[model samples]
Target chain A: MLHMLEKTIADNPLITAFAFVGVVIWVSNQIGRHLTGGRVAGSAIAVLGGLALAYWGGAVTGKAKGLADIATFSGLALMGGAMMRDFTIVATASEVHVDEAKKAGWLGVIALLLGTVLPFIIGVLVAWSFGYTDPIALTTIGAGAVTYIVGPVTGAAIGASSDVMALSIATGVVKAIMVMVFTPVFARFMGLSTPQSAMVFGGLAGTVSGVSAGLAATDRKLVPYGALVATFHTGLGCLLGPSVLYLAVKAITW
Target chain B: MVIFGTALLAACYLAGIWVGEAIAVLIGVKANVGGVGIAMIFLIAAQHFLKTKGLFPADTEKGVTFWAMMYIPVVVAMAATQNVVVAIKGGPIALLSAVGSFLLCFGVVALINRSMQRHASPEEADASAALASAPDALKSR
Candidate 1:
């Protein structure tokens, strides 16, 4: 019986992968509810947990893909690929109403611009302070401050080294974690009760996962509003990062 | 009906990918032009169209929402499993930059919000509270 079950899991890697993630999410949710009283979102905890697991997996397998490096877990690579990510991102459209989203108006647009530019400049300056003076590295790290997805996309576009790209991604991840943990704590101070404020907040924050989780913790209704605007930051950042931002950085440094 | 709904999603996604690629090509870049973003725009436009035409179904939206919520946890998992080893090996600079940039962003955003609040009226705050207190389901719809 045990051998047959093991063989089945080995043969159907995708199913096994799903099962593994299911358990992790369940455990994370339980931890969130019981320990944190839902103060911290389960998704944030789960993501953090998954990172720890990935680290352990990498150390054990001497592979970069984490648990996906294992034979049975290889399906996770496909499950977590760009296709699924895009599908999920698209799926969010079903919940959004164009007319309703427009309530935030021009202020929302200004916030989005500020969100992208401010983070990028800060990221570049920090990188410079850290002794990364190369234009490509600075731009990549700065773009990563825009969002994790933008970081890798910008890195690939500007011909940044893999290590530099990874740094950019890490920078974005740290930002996301901070947003997730602190948004609720600071919600009142920031006047985050309304949809308008939420939209502006999302636009300024720029990281979808972070803003969504943060807003979710502060107020569930605000998540959709914030995420709607935050979603645009990725596209805008990607559009500007490699070409305009890269050139501006080169002009400054070179 | 579920199959049709799924197909609708796939069609929009494929079209979005095509548009993204076309944009990338036009810009002389060698990557997809925010395929996810384009896909989202397509999905939103299509959903509105379907609703206006009275062809949108609750079940279909429910199915999409299920996938959408599922995607959230996937995002979290993806973050945790990212290439931290390479990032760490890149050194203390990356870590410092992340911390520094985050602090700066928080400060600037807070300042902006506070300035906005200085001019915001009590009625606006009341209205915001009322909106926030509305039923979650109706608000989502």
Candidate 2:
């Protein structure tokens, strides 16, 4: 059974990742609902789903690769935790004075602009350092995901956990649409292979999901849960890393 | 990595808000205040809807539904795009940017709330005092 399971995952990384993510999501939702007696459990489920995916994915994929992948996964897990901390601090803070609403609105606008621009600039720089061609497209996709998913998740989480179900559904749907619509455009823009493009986009989705979950969490207690979700997602990606790598190599070689 | 998308999403939301605001202005709609009034209306509507549905008390499914809807597009995008490497590399930058923007908005709002509290009118203060004293008075009686 173990051999068969390994073979199945080896042959179908995408399917495995999808199945793993789905299962985690469902289980987390059920557990969260049971515990909180509210829908905030969905968010908790998202967090747990991400973590479980990462852990299982990592364990499966890291078997022959030694500890490097494990270390990377661990690092990502830490970062995920850190991201949650920042979100918690900001969420717990009191709302601005009523008189400052206008100021806040203006500031929000400014923040929005900066949020869009700064990441692109940084991504471009990073890509350039790595000698990657046409970093702009990658940057755009990355920044766009954050703007769309992360902000709302954080806003919803901090302000109201009730928003989680709606946000999750909306995000999932939008992301699916964007992936179908934008991937080809991005592929042409970046002149990247399909696999490369897919990996980049998938990574973007995972990151946004993780960060959004972190930002949306109200209680400090939930940070670990959120981090665990991210870790799981990352692990799943890593576990399937070899298959993805094989596909990329084949595409490049061909 | 998907954090990058936050910018685009924010742009979309802002665009939606702008359109809403423009329509209101074009129609010559008047309110006690401008943006806040609009936002307050939305907030109240959301709160009322939740309360009416009994989802605000011990029920949170409605809110969860809202989040799930938002995530649908996101998940679709993920599924469509097969690339995971670029996302992993770029995820942190995108997340940080989004968080920064959110904090700026949140902090500004908090400051506004504080200012409003500080600038309360004497009449408003007296009215609040009366309201607070009334409950105690009733208890004493």
Candidate 3:
């Protein structure tokens, strides 16, 4: 019986992966409700918990893929791969209504610009303070502060080394998670209720997944608006990062 | 369950990625630029088109919701894939930059909201506007 179950689990890795995530989510939700008293979202806790587990996995296995590197959870690598990531991103748009999203007008454009530029400046400043004087590294990491996608795109465009590009991606990923966790926590203080504010916030937030997740937590209606505007960040960041932003950073440093 | 919309989603995803790749190539980057966002746009357009044609089935929403509710799990899975230990070991700069940028940006966003409130966009003052007081907003789909 045990051998049969083991073979079944081994053969159906995706199902096993779903089961594992299911249990993690169930427990996390209970903890969120009972322990946190619904102050912190269960989903947020699950993501953080997953990160912690991944950190532990890396510490123990000395591998970079996190929990996906483990043999039993090997299915996680596939489940969390680019295909699934992009698919899930695409799928969530199912609920979005176009007419409603059209509410964000030119104000959204300004928000998107400020959202992209502000973070890039902060990123460049931090890199500068950290003693990174190279134009390519500074631009790449600053682009990363915009979004994980922007980071690599800028890095590749400006000839940043692979290590620097990786760092930029890491920076972007951390920023995404932070946005996701903090969006709901601070939603009330920020007047994140209306479609207009959501659009503006999405512009300033500057990440599709992070903003989508955050807005979804705050208000389902706001997700499409925030995500609609937030989607522009990458293209704007990618355009500005390698050219205008890089030049500004280089003018002062180089 | 009909489990519809997957085909539409896959088609949109592929189109978005192809266009994203083309954009990246045009700009001299080796990555798929805005593929996910583009895919989402395509999805939205396609759904709208389908609805106009009356080809959009009401039951299709079920399929979409099935995947949509799985969003948090997907996020968790994605988070689990990141090797946080190695990222931290890369240096403090990456972490510091992220935190500092977030702090400043959040402050700026708050300022934007405060200014908006000072002007008071009619519905915003409706006592239920607060996230906690708004029952419907809190009930996430």
Candidate 4:
């Protein structure tokens, strides 16, 4: 029976992938509820679980793409590919109402711009401190500070080394995890109880998952408002990271 | 009716991809011009237009919302499987830079928030104070 199940899963990669994700989500939710008393978002826990699984898979298979390296889990690569990423992003955007978004007003816009530029600057400085003196590496790492998505995008654009690009991504992920863990704890101190404030928080935080999970822990209703502006941060970071920011870093470094 | 909404989403996504590609070409860049961003803008605009025209059905909105909710879980999954293995192998610089940036960003945000609060009008401050005291108010949709 076990052999039959293994063969079935190996043959139906997509089905196995879905089932694997389902189990992960279930276990993560269980951990969230029981361990953290739902103070941590299930999504956050699930992500941690997924990361653990990825590491374990890599160790077991000694291949890139982590779990996708496993024969039966090859469907994971496709499932988590850009197509699905873009699709999910679009779906999330579809939920935004323009009239409602306008309520964030100019404060949110300032926050969004500041959020992107400030993070980029800090990222660049940090990269410089780390001895990445080349403009391309600096810009890519700096962009990664804006968001993991921006890091790879900028690195690919300017031809940063794969190692630098990976560092950039790591930087972004660490920032994201910090945002996820700290948002609720700081929500009160930050005055994030209002929709407008939530919008600004989203812009400043600039990680969709982090802001969403943070807001979910703080106030479920604020998730949409926060996520709305946070979504724009990615676009703004992408636009600026490879162009304006890159040029500025180049002018300095060169 | 739900199928119509799904079709609209697909249309918006395709238009977004086209626009993103066109912009990238115009800029003479090899990278994508953020198709997801363009597609989102298109989706939002289309949804607004449809609503304004009163052509959008309630059922369609429900369908769209359902799909949008589903996307969050997908993101959680993506977050979990990102390139930690490579990042870890990249050396201590990666971890240090990440930690440094995280701290700097956090401190800056806190400072900015404090300054903004200090500059708030007395009435706005009062309102925020009340809101803070009763977070249940924030939880209601």
Interface RMSD, in order shown: 3.7, 19.7, 5.1, 4.3
Per-prediction DockQ, in order?
A: 0.43, 0.04, 0.39, 0.37
C-alpha lDDT of candidate 3 relative to the true structure: 0.73
Per-residue lDDT value at A246 in model 3? 66
- With candidate 2 superimposed using the best TM-score fit, by how many Å does residue B1's alpha carbon deviate from the native? 41
Task: Give one digit per residue, the lDDT tens place, for model 4 in A1-254.
Answer: 99998899888876777777888888888987898776665665665566666767677876666677878877676666556656665766765667655655687788888888887888888778867789888888888888776676667656676556656766776777778788888877777766667777888888777788788888977787777778778766765776667777877887
Give one digit per residue, the lDDT tens place, for model 1 in A104-128.
5687789888888888898898888
Off by over 4 Å in 2: A1-22, A30-41, A44-254, B1-82, B120-141
Better of 2 and 4 by lDDT: 4
The CA lDDT of each predicted structure is 0.73, 0.32, 0.73, 0.71
Q: What C-alpha lDDT, on a 0 to 100 scale, does residue A221 get in candidate 3?
A: 79
lDDT of 2 by residue, B90-123 (tens): 4444334334333332343334334545676787
lDDT tens readout by residue for model 1, B98-124: 676666666666777777778889887
> Which prediction has the highest DockQ against the true structure?
1
- By DockQ rank, best first, the candidates go 1, 3, 4, 2
lDDT of 1 at B27: 75
Residue A23 accuracy (lDDT) in model 3 = 85
The DockQ-based CAPRI class assigned to model 2 is: incorrect
